[model samples]
Target chain A: MQIDHSENIVELKNISFAYGGKNVLEDITFNVHKGDYLGIVGPNGGGKTTLLKIIIGLLTPSHGTVHLFGQDICCFNKWSKIGYVPQKATNFDNSFPLTVEEVVTMGRYGKPKNDKIVLQSLKQVEMLEFRNKLIGDLSGGQQQRVFIAKALAGEPEIIFLDEPTVGVDLKTQEQFYRILKDLNKKLKLTLVLISHDIDVIASETTEIACVNKKLIYDNNPENFLRSEKLKKLYGSGVKFVFHTH
Target chain B: MEAVLSLFFIHTNMFDIFQYGFILRGLEAGLIIAVIAPLIGIFLVLRRYSLIADTLSHVSLAGIALGLLLKINPIITALIASISSSIFIEKLRINKKVYGESALSIFLSGSLAIAIVLIGIAKGFNINLFNYLFGSIVTVKQIDVYLIGILGMVVIGLIIFFYKELVYVTFDEESAKVSGINTNFINTLLIVLAALTVSLAIPIVGILLVSALIVLPVVTALQFKKSFKQTILIAEVISIVSVFLGIFVSYYLNLATGGTIVLIALGIFFLSLFF
Candidate 1:
């Protein structure tokens, strides 16, 4: 596949990061274009989420430069343009007395609450009926949908999700991916997803970036599956059935 | 007929107690503190930072002791000490220099130590110190009432201004930051408001029981599992009721104001648990 540097929305050049003496990511270069669905796959500690955090400016790399929307990350203040759904979205104190609508309204923090936008976001996730319900009362799958709605409430052009489907049921996971694909195709929203389900993510995303403490593979999913890079990251005997649909 | 008459008579006496200037001043301050404490309390309780109130209260005690030693207005000194310490605690928590609970415990005991030393230097506890320690309603001066009123409005106004951001940060801080909210500024603002609320509350709830005023009503309101706004409103109602009833009952029965208020709040909590 041919690459177009002029249309790049995110550019990371020679990024290296370490925690104390341990190097988590080293000399990584990647770019995400507008409206691209990029999947980042790696082992549990392979720095997939760390890379995502770095792109979002949550963590600074020890070496390298990150440019978001053609501007240096340090000078990039248009955070509303990029939405984020962190890992384990359910890890918050569920019993916190917040309604689903209240949680969604948080997407527009530092601004006046807008019921129309909140309702619209909820409608996108089909969670409008549960707006008045307590956040903790919903099932795990339902909660994940609400979080997606929350990210959507900001009307972001790009969204970065880290392990978003963890602990959800299989059917819900398929539905979740469908919703994401719909958003990407219909709204032309850029998505950066981190996942462990190699087969589904392989078939779902437009491009794949495999990491094992480094950028082991970066290209179209067809080449990723046809190539021998999966074994290099997941090791020998790692079996995966590439779903046609 | 006799029970009905006695009930009416007691209600009349309750209203009549407001005639005294000190009682009026105390009630005004107590009402304002009632509103301010739980407004901040709901956020603190939701964020699992309820201990911040207790830690700041202890620091306020040291400030009060310092004021007593120097013969200055204790409320002003307590205000300075608590606001400063609250900022320090927030920074320590943010910088990861100390575990949050460890920091709270350290400040709690360290400030108490300083307060004890100051009390000793001032020749030990006196009538004034006792009033400050346990809360004497009649001792609430007119100037304290004015100060409380001004600070109470400031706290309430800030909460109103930062309502959405505060709720967002309390619910999920990282996401709030991701969405362009300056979470550190919001957090610091909250702790500073908490400091002001605690210092103002000291004159009514006293050092030892001030946390109850800040925590109990909110916890009790949490029992209903209402929405965030509803929970805060319920907490305000519960706090106002407790403060008013406690002040009135203590006046008639000659009881400690802080203890009486806390007991009423505890009673509400237990009742909610039962329901």
Candidate 2:
């Protein structure tokens, strides 16, 4: 599961992000290489989502530079290569009148001739059968799948998901992670996932980046489990139980 | 049975009405508004800015009053006023201190106050003011028809060209911005278009009922479980049918044109809820 450093797709150099005068992320650094499943776990209000937003270019870091594909993140214009599934995707208005296929097609907006890609992306998420169904009619887990398909329709090399399992049932969450594993292993797509469930994502992701307003741990999941980082991030009341499938 | 039959035969009566030049011009303007209003309405309803349409309509009424006092084209004056006020409202919405609904309420009340004061200063309400307030299909002029036609073409063209972008922005604005769509420009353009639609629709539906023409059809369409494109198509169909039938009924029954049209759209909405 080790990713070569020379082939890093995302590199952050002393990334520090703040909202107004309040510091959200301070003096953080990390690298995501091709085909790396990097999981970001943090406590509530610990700046996890802000860090993801900074990396995805939704928010600018106040003090540091980001390099995507070895280019300055600000100037990197090939946004089609990086797909984003925002946290709010799960809470979209159920009355919205969009079909699954149309939602997927939104990912292909700036691209040319995406009919085949749209179907392929839907199939990847196993949602091809429900492509014509209204998005509001689908269950929350199914809607999340459609959102992932929307990101995939652009045929992106890297995908970033922000707390995607919120409000989803336990079984569906397991299935969702299985699909992410398949996307990483079969499609060779790099993934950056943010989750509050430290133990669950630690088991699934190859690398774990534990943060509490700063980069605490940036290593493989095994080392993350053995280290004192989890204890530092969350106090003695927090328990870590690793389950193998 | 006879009433139903006469209602059916009202199609011929509609033809007789259309034979007059002024009635024909009114029909032209009414049909164009039927299309443009619902197109703008879909976005407003989706974005939770349906009330903004109502506020802008009242603003257009003040514009019309100013034009009458100045002896100029009311539609042109209304267009200028609506666009200017819409930009101002957008700026207010962007300011962190002012909530969006608060901004809309301020404009809505402020514009109505302006209209009332102007009407009082200009020697009180006249038949012309009544016509502008409740709408008079028989009074539609050739110049109003031309203005509606040009504005209709521009609104329809913009909606068609930016169909996907508009849908994306409407469904999820934050995601659209991350995807590199100029969300601020699209949002401002949508507000401006809504303003243009309100001003142009005033003559056909009146300032009091213009938002109904823009909103009711979309609400009716929402009663069914359909796709976004389907919702828009159904909304347009409902609007067109209501405009034609409402105009015909008003002509034969001697009812107020704007009120009758809005009543028909409301009737259709109730029917949609039932079936």
Q: Evaluate all candidate structures by whole-model CA lDDT and list the values in order.
A: 0.89, 0.88
Q: Write the per-residue lDDT of candidate 2 for residues B230-268, one digit (tens) a residue.
A: 999999999998887778777777799999999999999
- Docking quality (DockQ) for each candidate: 0.76, 0.69
After superposition, candidate 2 runs with Cα above 4 Å error = A1-5, B1-14
* Candidate 2 lDDT, A86-199, residue by residue in tens: 898967778788889999999987899668999999998899999989898899899999999999998888999999989999999998999999999888889999999877
Model 1 ranges off by over 4 Å = A1-6, A110-113, B1-12
Q: How does model 1 fare in lDDT?
A: 0.89
Clash count, one per candidate: 0, 0
TM-score of chain A of each: 0.94, 0.94
A1-245: candidate 1 lDDT, tens digit per residue: 34343488889999999998999999999899987899998889889999998998888999999999988998888888888888968988868899999888887654566889989999998899999999999988899999999899888879999999999999999999999999988888889999977877788899889877888656688677667877877788877777677
The Cα error of candidate 1 at residue A95, in Å, is 1.6
RMSD in Å for model 1: 2.5
